[model samples]
Target: MSSTKDIDALIDLMAKLPGLGPRSARRAVLHLIRKRSLLLIPLADTLQAVAETARECLNCGNVGTTDICDICTSEKRANGELCVVEDVADLWAMERSGVFKGRYHVLGGTLSALDAVGPQELRIPRLLDRVPSEGITEVILALNATIDGQTTAHYIADNLEGQVRLTSLAQGVPIGGELDYLDDGTITAAMRARKSF
Candidate 1:
């Protein structure tokens, strides 16, 4: 039996993760093996714990360890503003900037005609429900600038025309860009300069 078989399998698995190719995965696996006690074991333990406890927030679709995420329950975040994002990664990006104090609504994904995705496939219904129930006075569309993202934003805007104030992030977020790839400064600028939809 090959002694390197398990290591090769580990590299293969890691390579499947985003941004990690075979070469990068091999290097990472080697580093982890070298730091087994300090990094590898702890990482494995955390991954297991997260895998078992991770769940989508019942009210906002944010990923967390409980049914309701901390942001949803925080009275401090009850600022009558709701930020809608296409994914949890976008939510995290907004949070990293610390510019938006309002609650978030993750749509899971954008509307895609090619992929047969629509409002029903996302969390649009829940978003509409939250607007009235949570007393949201404003909604900030923080979705990506991709065609699908723009399409999804328009749909949400049309459905919520007369309910509340609607706004979208301004400059800095390039066309066809994603929130996850933007820097904190760009996110802050875009948020601070948001405009009406």
Candidate 2:
């Protein structure tokens, strides 16, 4: 048996992560090996802990170590508004901006016709239920600028019309751009300038 077999397997697994290729994974693994006591050991412990505990919030679909995420459970965030986003990453991006005071609803993904994804596939039904249960006065659609994202937003708007005020992030969100790529200032500006959908 080769002594480097386990290390090679680790590198292979790391390469599968987003934004990391084989070369980068190899370099990272080597660096981690050099800093084993400081970085690698702690990182391994954290990864194991997270792997065992990470779960999606039952209320809003945001990922956390609990049944409900911190944002969903916060009384301060229940400000009569709910921001709808396509993914957990988008929700995290919005939170990082520290601008939106209200709560959030993560849709998981856009409505994809080709992939046969529909409202039922996402958290649309749960979002609709939350509107009435939570007394949400406004819903800010912060979905991506992609075609599927807009389609999903429009569908939600149609379902929610007359029930509450519906709005979307302003035009500064470039076509095909995901919320995760935008700067915090741009996100804040788009949210502040949101218009009726």
Candidate 3:
């Protein structure tokens, strides 16, 4: 057996992670090995724990350690507003802003025709269900500024017309920009200046 088999496997797995390449993974593995007690062991434990327990929230599609996420279960978050996002990362971005005091609806992805992704493929139906059930008075579309994102937002707006107030993040968000890339300040500003869709 190869003496470096396990190390090679670890590097391979790390390389598969987003934003990580084989070169970076090798460096990271070396660093982790050097700091085993301080970082590696703790990171490994946390990864294992999260891998086993992390799941998408049934109500809003947020990732957490429970079937229902903390935001969905919290009474304080039920402030009659629902912020809709194209992905869990976007939801997390909004949370990092610490400006919105409402719950969130993660759509999982945007509606795409090329990939054959539709509203049914996303959590659009569930979002519709949550509108009245959760007493959501406003739905802030915090999706990215891409064509697919805008298309999905418009579709949602059309579907939920007159049921509740509809708004979208302000125009400062660059075209094709995803929420995850925006700074907390920009997110807060966009949320604050949201206008009717």
Candidate 4:
């Protein structure tokens, strides 16, 4: 029977977001309440808009406001090279470095036997479909370095074998590292030193 039940609910919802815990969510909610006009209102509006309009890109599995993401529709990005990642966060990390010039294919997640996630569960079939249609010459597997990530990468490489040149980011990356967690410089170096797998 807290007087601030609505605010507490807001904190609970925010805490569910990745990287934000209960303490952080409470602080954030308090800050938003204090700055309602400057931050809270705007954030609420934007969240509402995104909730209504955000969707997966039909072509590349990217999260966007349209059926096809901007990268997939951009002619300049169609360079015969496709970088495959486990999530949209990894794709955004790669884009942050401004190193990759080609298009991207987001696998949504890695194959996990324990989780029972297979190629069909993810966007693998769509990836295979895109390769031939888009005239892709190379596919760079930019997945994380975990066991599940490696397993997924091997699967994709096997499926795409003989169709295009397959490569992976170089090994300056630590074991179990996720692309989204790597610094921009590290991502740049790894991408630059990518080799055939």
What does candidate 2's lDDT look like per residue over 1-197, in tens digits? Answer: 25388898999999999999999998899999999999999999999999999999999999999999998899999999999999999988998989899999999998998999988999999999999999999999999877899899999999999999999977667678899999887788779878899
Q: Could you give candidate 1's per-residue lDDT for residues 48-85 as a string of tens digits?
A: 99999999999999999989999999999999999999
- Write candidate 4's Cα lDDT for 53-125 as tens digits: 9999999988999999999999999999999999999999999999999999999999999999999999999
Please rank every candidate by TM-score, starting with the best. Answer: 3, 2, 4, 1
* Residue 178 lDDT in candidate 1: 100
Q: What's each prediction's TM-score?
A: 0.84, 0.86, 0.86, 0.84
Superposed on all Cα atoms, the candidates' RMSDs to the truth, in angstroms, are 6.1, 5.9, 6.0, 5.8
Worst 10 residues of 1 by lDDT: 1-10
Higher lDDT: candidate 3 or 4?
Answer: 4
**lDDT of prediction 4:** 0.93
- Model 4 C-alpha RMSD vs. true structure (Å) is 5.8
Error of 2 at 164 (Å): 0.5
Q: Please, what's the RMSD in Å of model 1?
A: 6.1
Write down the TM-score for model 3: 0.86
Give every collision pair in model 2. none
After TM-score superposition, the amount by which residue 56's alpha carbon in candidate 2 deviates from its true location, in angstroms, is: 0.3
**lDDT of predicted model 3:** 0.93
